[model samples]
Target: MRTYLEVSGGGVMRKQPYVCGLDAAVDVIDGKWKVLIIWALNHRRCRFGELRRLVPGVSEKVLAQQLRELEADGIVHRESYDVVPPKVEYSLTELGDELNTALGPLGAWGKRRMAVLEEAGQD
Candidate 1:
């Protein structure tokens, strides 16, 4: 027989959907445009059209889908105005802010790696 030990922290068991930390993070930012969406909303809140403009090559349907997934994962907050010509804005939640900070070093490393790769390619 196999047994799994329940992990409880801060006096409460986390309700995380993924069993592994990396898996959980990957599950939240799985799609191609999700990380870009997170990066775009890291500093400022943006509307649907704004996100579409910021993330080039992404279609309207894909953006909407990614936003919905992010919102579901509790990484992004969606605020809708109760006015004519409806306005909706998205911003990162606390969890998302932490995620952005966590990914910053990785982003920098990727930049350095890209530069090295470019140089290597030229050789």
Candidate 2:
């Protein structure tokens, strides 16, 4: 018989085992747009237009949807100010900062891999 150890936050054991044995973290940030949005917000807070400009190739509707989802997940915060033009801004929450920290190494790995792919004419 094989025994599996389920390790979670702070090395604590979970009472209920995962269905597929995969972490739920990935599910929260799943999809191409979500990561891109998080990456853009990782640097600083941005207005709607600024975010749309920073992430190239994303449609307005899709971007809005991604932002809403991130906001609902508590990883991103959306603030609105009563102004002439209805000012709105988006920034990473505390959870998002932690997530960003974890993703930094992955981003670095991707950068290195991309450089290699470019040299090999794959990118």
Candidate 3:
């Protein structure tokens, strides 16, 4: 097993044992619904309904839970306004924008790989 160190202020804070090769940073965003939520919010700010439509097969309860977690992690911002019907919107924070930028290439790679797999299976 490999041990990884957490660095803070350019110094090693503590040593952590690697469990799955992925570090804690990846673990935080490893929730089942997190990536989906991030992908949905990538294009623009969306309301609850819009998000629901964008992410198919996610239950309302799960979506709400994921949003709360994302907001707590400082990756997403939830803004509520005082209005007749109570308008609420969700958008990615600067941190989230950075994460999304990193994920763009991964997403494209997955799409291309899937296409290759489908073509090969047709033979």
User: What digit string (tens of lDDT, one per residue) describes model 2 on residues 43-120?
Assistant: 599999999999998999999878877777678999999999799999999999888888888899999999999999
Candidate 1, which segments miss by more than 4 Å at Cα?
1-19
How does residue 98 of candidate 1 score in lDDT? 94
The best candidate by TM-score is: 1
Top lDDT model: 1
Model 2 regions more than 4 Å off: 1-22
> Using Cα atoms with residue i matched to residue i, what is each candidate's TM-score against the true structure?
0.82, 0.79, 0.77
| Cα RMSDs, all models | 6.2, 7.2, 6.3
Which run of 10 residues does model 1 get worst, by summed lDDT? 5-14
Q: Which ten residues in a row have the lowest lDDT in candidate 2?
A: 9-18
Model 1 clash pairs are none
lDDT against the true structure, per candidate, is 0.83, 0.80, 0.80
Q: Per-residue lDDT tens digits of candidate 1, residues 5-24?
A: 33443232234556678866
Position 80, candidate 1: lDDT: 96
Cα deviation in Å at residue 22, candidate 3?
5.2
User: Of the pair 1 and 3, which is ahead by TM-score?
Assistant: 1
